[model samples]
Target: MEKYVPEKDERAPSAADTTALPTSSNERTPSMILEDLSDSGRPATEEEIKTLRHVTDQIPLRVWLVAIIAAAERFTYWSTQVTWQNYIQYRPDDEIPGILGLGQATAVTVNNAFNVVVYLLPLIIGPIADGKLGRYRTLQICTAFYLAGTCILLGCSTTPAVEAGAALPGFVVALCLTSIGLGGVQTVTTPLIADQYDETVAKIAYRKNGERVVIDRDMTIHYVYSIYYWMANAASLGMILTSLLEKYISFWGAYTLTTGVLLLSVFILWFGKPYFVLCAPSGTVIPRAFRVLWIATTSKFKLDAALPEKQLECGHEVPWDARFVKDIGSGLMAVKVCLAWPILRLCVGITSSNSIAQAGQMQTGGVPNDLLMASNAIALVLIGLVVENGLYPFLEKHRIPFREMARIATGLFFMAVSMAYGMIVQALIYKAPPCYNFPLECQGSDGRIITEPNHINVLVQLPLYILVAVSEVFAFVTGSAYAYKKAPPNMKSVLQSFYASMSGVGYLLAVALGPASKNPGLVVLWGSVTGVMGLTAMDNGQTRKDPVWHGPFAHDVPNSISAFMSQYSALSLIRGLTSRTCTYELKGVNFAYLPLARPHAVENSQPSQKALSPGLSDPASDNVHDRPSGTLDIPEGYISTGNYIPNHNIVPTSALR
Candidate 1:
């Protein structure tokens, strides 16, 4: 109950108080009440700011429910999306109708265009979620559009009107609607999950086995994102089936399977509504944050990181509080890091979109080009586990903290190397090929034109895929956490949108570079990508409020659908659909989605109360609110408002266990 009101006597903490925080467990026992009050808009003293990274918290079980919803969504989106490239580029004259069979150049262009729409839509949708509809409501509306879009596309493939080589207009319409839905779902989902946790305090916690530790907001969020990332990748493994389905069965089957998953996600979200702690949109948070940024940039304001408590005077009067000014500073720092992503992500674009194209050129030993992504997904899952649990903790223990910026730089380096690797692969493919330009027409002994793959092994492409996964581990995964950690709480979704937008920018640039994916330009394309990525390489971050990862597209699917990823993805890359006509291609965003699962403040279920681990105790300050006698049963800092007042019957935090 000791809400942070400045003391009338001392202006700030004394030099002695500013000394390093307690290193031993006995020296630093935090009070849950004090920590809870700190979360309720309490200002940090100078010293607290410096040591913030040292603490982390246990991710609540409720957050996992939200993660599950995102997983289901990833499963559905990928179930059908991994088939975009082949559906557009490969002409099926003998097998089935090649509906709207645009050439490879046109198809990749369309794919880029679709990606641009999906990534950019977040800008529009983010504001709406924060101002008009809340995140939960926004998700519902978006999911409907997503489902409808899939249904329309499904009918396009199944209807009798689509003749062999004929174009389907409904198909384009479906992509548009789904774009909005995808954009809307992505912008709101991550932020919504973040809001579910009680991030008001950090405490000295223990591993389930009694090892002493610190649990704070940053670690808690990082943990949630790690789990969120792993779940999304796990769901992506489903795309293997969808790829086979679209190849062997019908596009209708693939799209239908997707719709079913989408429906499942929607169902989970609706039924579990009561369990969630819905966040009301904070009006115009993004606008205000940007305004602060502008004011800070243009004005004569000087920032001294060592003294955040002493607000510097603004260069211009925009009527913002000191806290708002600090938030703007934080926002700008994040953006500075993010600016590098536009280039770094291009490597991802090349590998995810163009590499799949490259695979199509080389002779496949009966394995699908998109199947290589199974390696990427599996690598990401394992990396996530190893890095977050094994590596990160180990580093922290050794006092060699793994910085986010450094992680991002390393990721960029991986992208550079991967691009270079692809460049080499492309060169070798040309050297060994019968058709030098690939998909080349070779003359048989009888003089009939034979379309055969080059002699290069398809598995040679594994390094590039593995590199992309490794890059994601460092760049994409860490970036998401960094964005969440660095972004102003109110402007979190906006920051995430900023992160997602980089992919769109990269893809747009990729469209311009689409020609590079072709013959002589293949070397130039990969070489240029390598050079650009290496040159612009910088530290960065990604998110739901954190970036989500998506995978590449596949064409045909079997009984299973496909796996689509988000920002570790933009998630639309892997999805391809088979068109008997091969004339049309459906490219969608591959971001994962999950049904919403909120934990209610019920006993023996999930705890809605702020949890404080053992060995933590708050100072019995004079200003602290008096606890009601015998109502010790009430959850700590339980603010009774609306209809309910504190009563003896109220359940305590102990009731959670």
Candidate 2:
């Protein structure tokens, strides 16, 4: 067995080379030959570059698999939710209100509770996936849980012997399981994509990555969040069909159908596993340190690390200075201010004023109300896509900053208009008599129940969707992007959860306020007030925090403070807020969710001296012993090195000294 050594001048043999030499001891030593090859300088040619580019163009198959799985999971989630209330509310006329209310209440509670888990899971799952099971396996485990939950729901729906109460528990359990799955999927898949490809490749492949490189995990997760939400809605579109199918078939049939889709997702993920690069989990040291630091500041716990060593000045490390803690406290105060301002405005302008107005409209047929509610979802889907992919691009091209405050301002304005639209519809409904003498209702020959006509009321409220849509485009999308960009790298997943948490807070507020006001006029009035406050905040250059005093005592506080703070903070934050620059830049960059099309040209053309062949001999050395040995040993009739010398083709001594 001869030792083999790589040579520098091994000039990659051309296709024309076709001769092989028998191994002999007299040949130059492989080490000497390797030394010669190391000294030889050769630049890569055009062909190599082209070959490299070709390889780089093909994205790994794993990305598509992950995407497909994500899409399927979303579809199943949405399909169930859209009609779950309707399905559960089915009852006789007498039991309708109680059953419907109970179902709605249960669903809402479950949604909120599940969200807590969903939000918190990322905090732990990110570190776990990065350190323990690896991304693919973790996703697989979560998928299994999701599938199990679907099966449980299917069984409960199918078993006639099971009481509704009993079945309800099963449904809750299933929801919990599915929520875990959702969290796991949310935590792992997006980060995995970011890990596999470089910045350039990601940009060309994923629309989100085109403008940014080295994005915070949060930003990457935002794209996943949007995609996941859309998938859920897309699945919901199947609800009508599922409901009809339940009428004709069985409830289990619908669930089973969804399960099948989930299984297909699992299959895709399994097959594509080979293409993903599993990132090793970060050790316990960094994460534990973060946890300690967070606790120390938030709970006033003492730090475990030594004072001098613990104080990290580099923005990347955990800051341990007492001032840093103060800054954090100030930041929290700012957030409190931000959260309170909007609520106060909404309470005064909309909730307090519109209670009776909303009640009056509710007295009319509920079709218009349903339409108004439905319009938000419709607008979210259409307008979100349009603004994110279409409008934002156009704006970016024209150099619009698309700042967070600008978006929040725009969204609040539209939201106010939406409330106003509702108010106008309410007024029309109020003017119409309970039994309008429109001959159209009584003209029917069949003795059918005649309901009040409120066509005018419904028709006028359609523009509310436009307002909601436009607001969502600015508030939700931009807010999400901003959150992810600003979040620290280690906290990417947690940061994404924070974005979800904000929306959760918004939903909670909506639910809380639903019963607070009984007049529609008041609601519209409060909405207008909030809209103005938002606008004032933007104009004054206030950051996210600018408190809006709420509560019964809110009237005591002068608007002057709110106005002054909003203007001053806006200017100060806009001028001095260097912290957000990185985030803003991230929003500009593009990221690819899928793998690169192929291996990059640069990677492939950069010669690995190991791959080259050894030359016949050195030209400068008259001493024959110093001559290089290895030669292009292509056998006659072979395009490549197809077994010219059995298992041991090139003698090790021939390629090196």
Candidate 3:
């Protein structure tokens, strides 16, 4: 590691300068080189080495409580979403009655636009959670919004409200409120759940089988997310009940029950307040992060130049420390990792809107049109259980490295497979009907056009839903784990929001495809999405293997290389500027005094021993008079008089005063 010492120059003193301040013994300095564990402690014994295996730590009960809150929220949110296509497309006169008589195109468009709002609002709410309101309080407010929205939705869905023509307007307002609430809930929920278990290092532990294993925090986090997602999917089963309610009763009955569940989540959150590991809002964190990035950018992306001492040496003032810069690096890395998510989101998004419409156009028999959507939840629960409890443990026990990025890539590939299947299914649907290319526009025997669905069984859509579930088990869970683990503590919500925002972007893309979502163009839409997913999956895999990606949250280049390159490039540029600079025209500048100086050397006087070790200083020796004459007097707080200035043309502080 290189030590950064601020240069003595003709510059004004800055409050941000830490050169005069002594470093605390407890303060951890940033290190570039990876720590060598070879000499860290005593070598493991032969028996210990042979029996050692990585295992997860026991998740706290409080974590489960948080997961339950998320599950309940998902339950209510998805329950409303699963019924959206049906509610918007069909009417009471249709076999499967619906509230709004909008066509399939309008329904898919509405669903896509709703998703856009649902995922986009997180960007606004994330900063609020990290700054003004804590995660717990923000979540409470969001639940209120959600409950209010659900109530309005129920009110507008009544037969009288539909007859009175207020359903469309009321649906719009309800969706807007629900989107805001759900977006805010999603932004903070996962991050809050992750906050409960803060152990980062792996510790050795003994299992009930009398086997010694390393309790890996990373693996534990992975497991937590898996089970968390499992519960989320389990709650998604609420959509099945909502669908049934919509069929047997009315849309009002279904939404009324969902509102109650959302209310229960509120109570659960309130009771768990005492147990939750609540972190207070650091109001200035996001702004400070932006300022750090501004500094780094202005300094030509030389991050170290944004450091306090470096900024001071360059005659600039700054408010952050080196750690803040490191955190910025971590945050940027998280953003970079999520760049591939939009395509994946585009693929998975088909299920919520287009796939529901696709299934609705097929022969559903007595099944509700959107009821097949529950297959995704069911498959996710089954797959999550098998993968989390079975496959993950087996891999860990055998030391198989199925890292987060790899899992994400695998998930992407699975999504591609599902999309490919969807493209084929659409083609099959087009080919299987009496109407052929136009199933909804079939001509009856009397020469009148019949608008009936095709003869393809909706059950064939099962594989598509199941594959998407498998993909979620791999991609969505691991991507979240990657984001949560990479983000700095204060910026957890922001990073998670960044991750979630990809889904919004994907939904926005889906909105663009609204025109093609109907009829013969559906095949082309599915093919295009499948192609994009495949390409992104390949790109993600290549990124994982790329040496440029040092670690999950490191910079594009290795830290050591980035620092060295920045410093070398900066020094070279400075040397070029100094070599050519000879004169500057002064216009109306007042100078109190200009001092003529020459270099003074204290022969055979070694520098202070403290200079060898950065971030360490002896306070007793931190005095202006403690050093030889002509040496810079750097002391605590104030800049001492007679400090050496490298440029003689500039006036000394004492002379100027």
Candidate 4:
């Protein structure tokens, strides 16, 4: 091994460096000590900083196994999910093959309602996984429900069950069970897969190509999620097979194949148990979180007051400690970041249900309307590959920061564009001869109701699906990565579920708008969705100024420090702090968790403020009231102000103002 050797003429360590030393003997290795010793911890030289590149670590085999599990689950899900609209809308005697013979409005309603249930159950199941059952046990139980529900759905699809009047009720029960299964699996699976790689801090490493790079855990997570989503969309191509089976074979055959795929996922989970990283259940987080919130409220919103030492000083006791307070604060920040998701999800709900119905009203050229939904899967796979391999690498090379919030905003913009296109398509479908303003309602010469759809080709819907895919790539994948990165291990499932449940809220809105899925109202429905998404995109762009936009704690530190270090003045102060020893450490700083800049701080700034930094003045003596409303009280240089390690006390300071 190459060894680091300290120079004999190196100066003695400063008191701050000694205080910051790790207690563990293993952590104080010779290499580490020498590594610290050789450091001129003055701000990085401009050339040194400019040449830096962030890249991902090699993904583990165990993580791939988990990803395969997720892919299989998505395969089974979209197979059934995409087919539901056709299954509910048409009759066996009609041109389309279906069971229930419900109208388009009813089909839209049922499909979105199913989406609502699938997303909503995560809230109930997430806590159970986090606090009681643990991820592995919870996944196994949910898979069992998934298998049972699929079996029941297969039985309900049979001709005998339909004649016996048992099909509808059985279908309802199956939907409920399947929803539980899917929601629970989704709540636990995302975080569990991400948990396989636990390294958070970035480090300098050499690639196989012999190029030096920074192995960034955040970038690695970005790559992982991109791969995860790509696999999901690739697996969703199974919808084409299921749609074909439903058309040529039967719904029974379709359900049988999907149920088999689901079984494969279950088997993988069972077999991979030994290799997977399984975390044991950490007892109730939500209840304790509420208690911490109560403590914060009583103490005038100062979260530091919830610390165990603070509680002891006040002659009281609580179930949590200082770390848990930080966890809760981070969780809430994740929640705030996700607030715009519901509107975006509404766009997804429309694409899945109403968009399918819209396709049925256009010329399909003998292809099943449900098959067009597969276009979304195709676009997702293609776009995701290009983005992960092409776009992200380009960004990293150029050091262009395309953070999570920006990605989400880009997604919202795409969603709006997609919905606007859908509205235009609906208008064209309405304008076609024989249908004029009403599709599927025009009468023939004999005054009999005509079933023939409008003259518009179904392929026109491809652009809309392509747009939706772009949105998913930017918005949904980024959201998943954000949740996993920010959440504390114990609260991972809880936070992921809350993020997911927004989809249900969006679908529920679609369900409420069921009546608008048909005729002239289709135009209004698509237009309304377009408007909501557009406004949300604008709002999200503005949120770049918000504290939640700082991103994950790990992401904040190095980037902020590097940017701060680029200044010659900062280098001088760091050198002064080191007493010409050329070393300084930012100790006990918690600006990562603190919302430093107050509202209107950015609006009134000259060019604009860029980052928040820990101010030099002692935090314990600081008063928020003493500072100007839109000003952050930064000192001459950034430094840790006090011995605030355990409690992680906040000093609200903004830099680059």
Candidate 5:
């Protein structure tokens, strides 16, 4: 203490105030301080940066392990599905009717219905995982169900004298179990990736501070999804070989092989649990609000008083907490907005196109259709990589606003064109002989072949895949991004389910068209309808202000003030009629007269100047009122008032103000 040289002036240090610090005879500061600052200020060397990146960028090893498990699971599922109908038809000595077509159509229909549950369960399962079971544990339970289903399927195949009647029930049970398990797997895997890079610094570090990082999660998800597809193909290829082997080998051999693969998938997921970051479910406010909104929309009560105050799970008041209610209501409201346009008529056309495609595939036996299906998956994998890594970066660098809605519209147009091309191909193929011989060999009691050649019907349908692929580049990838961005964070699973539902709707339309196509004129009529719809979609896409709803009721009148008012005014002026006949008669009269009004308002109005301005600002007075209005002036050269800014030449706002 006695030897201290006034302790370096005993004050807080400053950049310019180092006067009391000890210095060498040359007047330089100590080397240690200089070195410390130099170390802090200098950019990291290449080797140092690389090392940092390696440590930070690591994805939990478990993700890769889970990916493998998922791939294997998909392999087992598709392997069974690809050959299921054929297996059922070939079962020993069974004289099944020409119902193979009916069976295939039924399978697709049943699959569509099952998908609603498959998709909807994730909503409930996600919470159960977060609240009751952990992610890893939930995976374990689901894996067991998947394994059990496979085992049951194998057992059912072995059962002697398994009549078609008995096999149906067994197959349905196995499908449901497998679907439920896979649904759980999907729900759990998505959240696991999110947990791995939950920290902001970790996300940034993993992204290497690059734009590519934003898509890193999706790339990883899809990469894992692609691996599953590849495994599925491998399994399918093996099954085809097995089908050939059936001439020399027992059916048990093929069943045993599939069972072994499924078991291995189970083992892989079980052992690799330790490396994953098992995230505890955090209480999310958004989900609570969503529940309230869902109830409001689906229930019979009014929006404000939809749920009783006592029943409101979210602590906040009903209307206040329901932010999504407005968005969803607005989206529904926008349905009417679409109905006013001629484009609304296009839904019928689009529905018809989807139906014809479906019915055509079914009638031709779904093999060519399956090949076309493969193209969509292939396109999805390629486009996801290209757009994420190539096109997006180019656009961003050039300051282009590649709006999500525009991307979706572009995709839909491609899809529409694909449908048209498919119809053209079908027209050509209608002149060729049927490709498959089995259908022609089966004869009716009159000794006439039950199925006759319709032409090279299957081959011409191949182009539909290319069209599907192009449409997917715009639809699937862009829609995935849009939904993920627009959906409330907690509703990711719900959004995925919603996306899957679109396919269900497509299938339903196909089923409906199958019966309708018995009349030859109906097929032509439907094609024309779809063509017009496609053209309308193209026109609306180019000129419309808002994105068009592509869902089931896309062309329906919105349930809004104008629609209600129109209906109310159209009602008969007669006083109360107590008789049931009178009420029925009145209902019939109302339907005949009341045409629901379409919404004319583009969107909800914004706050006017009077509402936004703080104090009175009279233009009549010469004195300029300088009250704190908080109203920002519209900067020169800016045209629109939305959140996004347009790219145009404009003076700096600071300079003008």
Candidate 6:
């Protein structure tokens, strides 16, 4: 392997310029960049080699606690939220008795509004976790709020107060409490799970296989989060249970069950406090971020600040440190990775609500209504396991990587792909034997009444559910992993909250199409959603190609090229084409990707050697002096490899050498 350095100062280049073709000296053909492992480590001992086995092998125990906390919270959130439309909107019948008995429009409106609040609250709470209350404490407080809300709803639902529209105001109050709590906890806990392992501390040992393996941080983080999602879905088993309770027992039973779960979660969180590695709150990055941007902007206009260095230095005698500026750049690049998330989520808002409503319309022989909507959560658990345990390890062993940007793009494509299935299901529903126009009370051709439902089975929707599940694993699980990896040490919760907010933004978009949600208009709406999502997928690809702020991603395409090549790989797919899923209920509602910059792990210079290694750094360097990690300063290349990164590209490793 050879050293390659950029001729220009890499810090200030626009995204387009940095990503444009590299100068010849540093440029590697896709072939040259695909060379063999260039590690300088000594041969592994037998005992060391024995330990190297699987990517999922050695996670710490506390990580599971965080996963439990996530799962419990998700269960409570989904159990209640899943039954909302039927509980609030559908007219009362023996099989499906109403709580609020509000009209369909009211249910949809309230649900959408509640979703907006649940997702949006993270924006405020994230800073609180980062700046004041540490993650562990914030998690505790937020969860208490969730428990409190569940108790309130349980009380209101069980008592006579819930009889009519009387319970409506109380329900609104409950929604507020749960949304604020759930949003903050969701945003903060993902980073909390990730923080369990130390990435910078790579503990290398020889595997029993005689091949040395790193107890790798990045891949471990990815794997833990995959399980995190799968576990949450498993916990969301509440969807089926609670919905059943609503249908058979009473709506109060479901709320009671959810409250119990939240209470248990709170206990476990506090019980395990001694074991958790709780990092204290680092002050908020957003305020510092604003100041940095302001300084960068003002310096651009000042006549005295001609040089890039001068611009950076101008007011920085004002508390703006170099690393903080670098962090802002990193955060921006992460934004590019997820920039398409909100727009992508528009499809989610449309489908989830519509799916529930459509199921309500289904002529089920005896199937429950909540069961159909619960499919999203169920599918997440099932497909998530297959991909994580069976597929990912296989790909890693073969050196085939699923690139972050590429996986997210695949998720976006599947968002559109799932819709295609939805369109088919809708069309089938229209053509079913019952009155196609029955929602409007249709009269048959022979003057006979078409009283019964069209005989089409609700099971036809299984395919769409499966497709959506596959998409969720591909998109959402990986998206959480990506956010954690790319976030700055201090601002992890804030970055994650930004990622979570995309769902709200997407729902905001979906809210615009509210009028068309009813029957007769639904088929047209689904078909339109499919088309728009496909275009959005293409747009996401373009964002991966070039982002707005141009920090980390602009400089880092090479590392992702192979990983992304999986979607484009010949005949090797997870499950048909749409397996690349993104985001979750609120979480899945966001994501896209761009490259990220690696900080100083790349160079070969000795710590003691102040002198350059020939063509490497200059003795008279123009860049500001960096605080030492003791490694010699080597600016990172655009593409840095990840643990499971693949040799998926057509070019052979042998060809590169």
Best by TM-score: 4
lDDT of 4 by residue, 180-295 (tens): 89998898889888888777655554332223344567778877777788888899999999999988898998999999888888888878799988899998678888888787
User: TM-score of each candidate?
Assistant: 0.71, 0.53, 0.75, 0.78, 0.56, 0.74
Which runs in model 6 stand beyond 4 Å of their true positions? 1-57, 295-309, 312-316, 438-451, 541-657
Worst 10 residues of 2 by lDDT: 584-593
- lDDT values of the candidates? 0.60, 0.44, 0.71, 0.72, 0.43, 0.64
Candidate 3 backbone collisions, by pair: none
Q: Which of 4 and 5 is the better model by lDDT?
A: 4
Candidate 4: which stretches are off by over 4 Å? Answer: 1-51, 298-300, 541-657
lDDT (tens digit, per residue) of candidate 6 on 1-657: 001212121122223432453448776432332232233133434344323333333667888988888888988888888888887875455245677767555676677767777777888988899889989999989988888888888887875776554577888788888887888888789999988865444444322222335454566778888878888988987888997888778889998888888877888887899988888997876876776656545654222232245545654344555456556655655665666777667777766677876766667666676578677777888777777777767654543435566577677777888998888788877776566734424677888655456667777787787788777788887788877776788989988889888778877767777766766777898898899887767655333322222222133221122222222221222332233221111100112211223334433222333422233243353211221233232222222232111111222222335
Local accuracy of candidate 2 as per-residue lDDT tens digits, 1-657: 011122334422212221232246775443333333321123334333222211112333454456667668765765554445434433313211112234333433444445456645766665666556766787889888889888888777765624455567777788788878877876766555444433332211111111111122233344444554454444445554454444456566678778888888788777766666665554433344455446554533433231333445322355344443433333232232334333423432232123222322334344312223344446667766766557655543432334455555565556556656655655565456543323113334466644334334444555754665565555555454444444334444444444444434444454454443332233444444456545544453442222221111112111112222333333333332222211111111111111112322111122233432343134562211232333222211112211112112222221233
- The residue-level lDDT of candidate 5 at 131 comes to 54
Across residues 1-657, which tens digit of lDDT does each residue of candidate 3 receive?
011121222122222321232255554221101121122112344343334555666788889988998998999988988898889988878756787878778888888888888888888899899988999899999988988999999999888998999899999999988988999999999899988887755554433322334555667787788778989999999999999999999998899989988888889877778888898998848778888777777776766566788878989777777787777776766676687777777776776788988887799988888899899999999998888878767654433335555566678778888999999988988988677777766788999876678889999999999999998998899889878877888899999988889889988888887777778688989999999887776556223111121111123322321332211121222232222211111111111111122223322233444433332233554322234344432211122223332221233344444
> What TM-score does model 5 achieve against the real structure?
0.56
Task: Kindly give the stretch of ten consecutive residues in candidate 3 with the minimal lDDT sum.
Answer: 582-591
RMSD of each: 19.0, 20.7, 17.9, 11.4, 15.9, 13.6
Candidate 5 C-alpha lDDT tens digits along 36-122: 232221234433332222121234456556656665665565455544534533334323221123443344344444544555566
The alpha-carbon lDDT assigned to residue 496 of candidate 1 equals 75
CA deviation > 4 Å runs, candidate 3: 1-51, 298-300, 541-557, 560-657
TM-score of model 2 vs. true structure: 0.53
Residue ranges of candidate 5 with Cα displaced over 4 Å: 1-60, 85-108, 123-127, 158-166, 199-258, 282-287, 290-373, 434-447, 450-459, 481-657
> Where is model 1 more than 4 Å wrong at Cα?
1-56, 94-98, 159-161, 164-167, 207-210, 300-318, 442-447, 538-657
Model 4, residue 148: C-alpha shift (Å)? 0.7
Sum up the clashes in candidate 3: 0
| lDDT of model 2, residue 433 | 55
